[model samples]
Target: MHKNFTHILTSLVVVIAITSCDIGDNKDVNPASSFLKIYDSHQFDHAIGPVDVVQTDTEGYLLLGNYRRDDTNFLGTYIASVDSRGEFIRNTYVQGSNVHPVGKFLLLGGQRYFVSMDAVGLQGYLNQVDDSARVVSTIALGVTYPMYAENDGTDQFILLSYNSVDATTVLSLVSADGSIANQSAFGIGAGQSVEEPIIDHFTRTGRELPFFAGRASSGLYYLNGFYNYTLSLLFSDLSDNNPTGVVQGQQDEGGVSGLLSLDGGQFAVSRFNFGDSYTNALATLNASGTTSSNDIQSNPMLEWEVDAKVKMISLTLDGVGYVVIGTTTKNQQIVLHFYDQTTGNYVAVDYLGFSSPYQLGAIEVTADNGLAILGSIQVAGKFQRLCLFKVSEGELLDLVQ
Candidate 1:
């Protein structure tokens, strides 16, 4: 089913009263120049949670999310396209046998596609759609759950799946037409691991590589890079591989949540620690995989004793720093933290949302250097609805009132 979703009327008024307060170096930044514009806030009849948002080739926006018709059953996946002004263009529900959509949107061969697993997670598929929101084709992928698809610069893509039955990691190189060109698997033995791989694209050298960062059974964080299409382990922390410095926390209770590429063959990673208290940390690594710097923060308001979670994170296009978004349990507000890479300073900390029960989905940088935060908001003490808004960097710095 499909419908023209509209922004919540009460949210428009709530946003105007919610302003960002500056807490860092703000001499040159203008808080007044910062503005929060609501492109659109949509409330779907069914419960929907956004996963990712990407700018279309035609300068529009496409939002991919999971939807549920009932509390117990998975309705399928939700796809929505909006214009530059956040006006609703069209939306459709791609029914699946699985409980959720576990994939990302890919733009390949000058076409748009939403690739994901079915409800049962045993099979994956790609929905090829036109600009007018019409599905032209649906390509099936014979894979299991915990799989992800990433573009390889060319029209082809790389699919990575973890086989729990055999304790193996499978890599498949898929062509643009949904055919698997090559497939391979690597065994990691019997261990509990968190697998979140990221594809890094370097603009200067036009090079791309995929790296998987997670916590192995050895109780240490490991980052492994793969050879293009071959699924060969280029480098890892294993005994045979040229292992770099292993990331060890006070307790082996945290795992990598996000990864960002930095200048000069360096990268930054975020980890969430759930020990006696909740903590979110950032670390930097050199090209050789050596940890250069590690900064950990636990519960910003220590006295309040509130729990804070790092829900999502993304680096700025210029690689200046990162924007960390999460929720504070006591205050029930979405917190934004701006980290300055060079100085190793948290330049700013701001808050959004007015009440508790606000869930954060994802964060993406806009074309004009602004930020688009995707999540859901509970209205009138009822159900949760999808909420999206853009905030300028200046606004985050408290330069604009």
Candidate 2:
């Protein structure tokens, strides 16, 4: 439940005529003009990448990511607020050993919270911040790789994490004030490990259903204690902690990087295959957690041997399609692929880069039918700084036409 940051510019006027430049192919497209603004983190020597972005009720934007003090092992989590015009309002950092923010902004009971993990990934903290980006409280949690968190439309939310010790998937129903209410664990069989659980809810038959996807060991037992890897999907009722269905992919080894709910028991997932060479694929699933369409590989845009990896995937607010973001192994440039959810067809692809390689972290549809992409841009061949791109909805649709 990574909150969409597209709502941040609700107060800003949408200018359909703004011109933009595509980094790859140097083509001039109409939607390219919709590139609104870009923000950079000047405080740190290197801003790793944005983990999440959210638009506040007051029309401001909150960003969560990591920053490095230098080219050393010192990594810190950062939270910042920006005005509707992409102007920085306030910025703060939680200094820790190799800290990386996980999940997105959580607005519950009229408060804002952001989650992150430490170097070892075993310990993490949820920071409560105000509109001014000031930390109000920090609640610690014992979890590694905090994958996803979704509210139950009440005072509680279900958090997905990985238990590094036992290699089990952990699900916890926690209160809005950062207190655990109930918890459950799912073991994917002995010698099999699970990681990167992404969760979302979709309305089907007048009821909202919660679904999750992640990577798990293929369960192909080896002589000692080895197992192949594959992607997994499951449908769960967070209220009672009951899992109704589970689905696993046929790929030899891969992990789900992004997930989006398309409603009516349908959703899309972005997966990275690590079986032989690095490849990416997109698939759609039905209510039963089963694949509804064939695996759509990166071959549509790049060859299978190009080594493309999808880092994030997000649905358009309209739920008609989704956008996939990642980096190409050769150029290391950030690449974005847009697809129609209904036909599962590729609409367009865009690349972004500065002087050095760009790493895309997160993307969300805006209130005005645009997209807000969060990532890091290398500056002067030295520092990697946080960067945000605002693309208008008109620009997005133009590419399809």
Model 2, 139-209: lDDT tens digits are: 77766656566545456655776655666556776776667876655554444222222211110112111
Cα lDDT computed for each candidate against the true fold: 0.49, 0.51
Please identify model 2 stretches exceeding 4 Å from their true place.
1-44, 68-74, 96-98, 118-121, 142-145, 151-154, 188-231, 238-252, 275-330
| Worst 10 contiguous positions by lDDT, candidate 1 | 199-208
Task: Give me the displacement of residue 246 in model 1, in angstroms.
Answer: 6.8
Model 1 residue runs over 4 Å out of place are 1-45, 69-75, 96-99, 131-134, 171-173, 180-253, 275-282, 285-330, 393-401
Cα deviation of 232, candidate 1, in Å: 18
The Cα error of candidate 2 at residue 61, in Å, is: 1.7
Give per-residue CA lDDT, model 1, range 26-60, as digits (tens).
45643322333222334435556666676666756
